[model samples]
Target: MSASELPYQYIVLRCVPRPEREEFVNVGVVLYCQASDFLQAGWRVDVERLHALDPRVSTDQVCAALEFIDAVCAGDPRGGAASEQPRGTRFGFLKAPRSTVLQPGPVHGGVTTDPARQLEHLVSTLVG
Candidate 1:
């Protein structure tokens, strides 16, 4: 199905560390459905995909990543409130780490870094 026809919204989670060190890597989680419906089918698929890509990552870590994406999308410098709001036409959620410098970095072995880039990769992987 096309992204517009999907049954639920999609979310992009980005993770970053405070103090900005090279060791601080950013990881993204693409959760399906609105934040309230995160336990649904599409969300499960995303969660499974995330685990399949990197089994070492924990659920808490993914949740943290989601929070980060939400902040960035909300345009809140402090990561915004931990509540769901009506996103515009995009029909998706976004969160990111509570950091200032949002830059690209290398992906570690077995980990999928960069939510936006990862989403693009996912689409290409499915289509091609």
Candidate 2:
């Protein structure tokens, strides 16, 4: 049977520069569509708000991490071997939780006909 929609998963990257202080700001988002072999990420950070959250929050560090997410989405060499794998695998790598200034949030799933549009919707609703 043909399918009109497919299930996908996503994670929002959060910056917790001051984890001890229990502060975090959403920095980016990662989305994966296994059926379509598509993986993409989008990010937007409010520097002033980030600084207000933690004066020590480093924009350079967060930007680099966000860029890394984009590179993984593009399968760029900068993303290393993980990005060279299939899109689903790349998504897995990106979605893995990490203890750092920037890290992926819990994985959320939904159905979508267009992964790109879903990505935009996720960014706007969850992180925008």
Candidate 3:
């Protein structure tokens, strides 16, 4: 890797309407670059798509979860104690597996100088 490139890791966030059936919709992405001290999240909710998967899914709850991701990434007080940790700890917390409507896909890695742009690209390609 060139000096201009920095290592980063990311996870594609998923909205699992029905965990028992294992059905999910790609919703967002969280990315962290330690070298650059960058952490951010980008997301979009396709209400129509989510409804098609499960008409009973609560769009409001899904959106609230996504907002929490953003707040955590920004280290905002609204994110609660999780946002108080260091950036790396915050990333680990977000990526940890959990049984919830909003779930992390898997950890993926790559090199990029611009973590923000890479985050946008990941969200567009992986979540869209």
Candidate 4:
């Protein structure tokens, strides 16, 4: 990649309504680029996909978790102390070291000239 292109990491946020069965649906994308000091997330609740997995699944916690991710990306104080740290820390904070209703998948990276565009592309590809 060109020098102008910075490397970035991203994780897919998923909703595992049936963790026992290990079933999940991609619900969001979090992208972070320390070189550009950029961090952002994009998400959507695909009701049809969600319902197909578990019609009785409640999304309250999933929605809240997604909102928290967005707040962290926005550098909102409400995201708590982690939001006050550097972008790299914030990115690592969001990565799921443990499984939850709203869990983060594996860490993936790529070089991109524009992090924003890359995030959008990922959201469309993986979260759709």
Candidate 5:
């Protein structure tokens, strides 16, 4: 990678209505570039798509969780102590595997000169 390009890691956020069923709907993305001290999250919830997976899925809860992720990325006071952690630590907390309605998918890596733009691109390409 060129000097201008920085390595970044990201995770696709998913809404797993039924973990037992092993199904999920892409709801958001979290990205971090330690080299550039950048971290952020982007999200969108398709109600129709989520209901199709499980009629009982709670969009509000999913949204709240996703919002928390965004807060953490932004180091917002609303995110509490997690947000106060170092950026890399916050990213690590987010990318850790979990079994919940709102959980992250596998971690992926790439190189980019603009971490923010790459985050938007991933949200469009993978979470859409």
Candidate 6:
């Protein structure tokens, strides 16, 4: 299906304690999805916000999220080559089969660690 025609979902992950205190504990995942044109863009913005909130968040993890979006836009979940169509016509405002998967870990920690693995698991779960 076309990116615009496909359904999309977003899942946000934040540290526990709604008001977010310095000593807040780890929280589980939070998932939200609605038909909207701004989901993908919001995901990008959230990545920045996530890093700002916790400098520990690694660039690799954030890149993973961005790469996921790029893959979907290009119609390749595996991060393959972009489709033949022109960039403007590719997405066409349709929501893609996109999702944001978040995992908590120490800031600046290696993405090769547990949280990154967890994120990979989430992607695999969604891809299947």
Query: What are the Cα lDDT values of the candidates?
Result: 0.37, 0.87, 0.95, 0.90, 0.93, 0.36
Best by lDDT: 3
Candidate numbers, best lDDT first, in rank order: 3, 5, 4, 2, 1, 6
What clash pairs does model 2 have? none
All candidates: CA RMSD (Å):
11.3, 1.6, 0.6, 1.1, 0.7, 15.1
126 Cα displacement, candidate 2 (Å): 1.3
C-alpha lDDT (0 to 100) for residue 29 of candidate 3 = 95
For model 4, residues 28-67, the per-residue Cα lDDT tens digits are: 9999999999999999998888889999987777788888
Q: How many backbone clashes does candidate 2 have?
A: 0
Worst 10 residues of 6 by lDDT: 105-114
Residue 56, candidate 5: alpha-carbon lDDT: 92
TM-score of 2: 0.93
**Better lDDT candidate (2, 4):** 4
User: Which segments of model 4 are wrong by more than 4 Å?
Assistant: none
- Model with the higher TM-score, candidate 4 or 6: 4
> Mind giving the per-residue lDDT tens digits that candidate 5 earns over 7-111?
999999999999999998999999999999999999999999999999999899999998889899999988989999999999999998888899888999999
Error in Å for residue 61 of model 4? 2.5
Sequence-dependent TM-score of model 6:
0.28
Worst lDDT 10-window in candidate 3: 119-128
- Clash pairs (backbone) in predicted model 5: none
Q: How does model 6 fare in lDDT?
A: 0.36
Q: Give per-model TM-scores.
A: 0.28, 0.93, 0.98, 0.94, 0.97, 0.28
lDDT of 3 by residue, 44-119 (tens): 9999999999999999999999999999999999999999999999999999999998999989999998999999
- Shift in Å, residue 99, candidate 4: 2.5
In model 5, which regions exceed 4 Å deviation? Answer: none
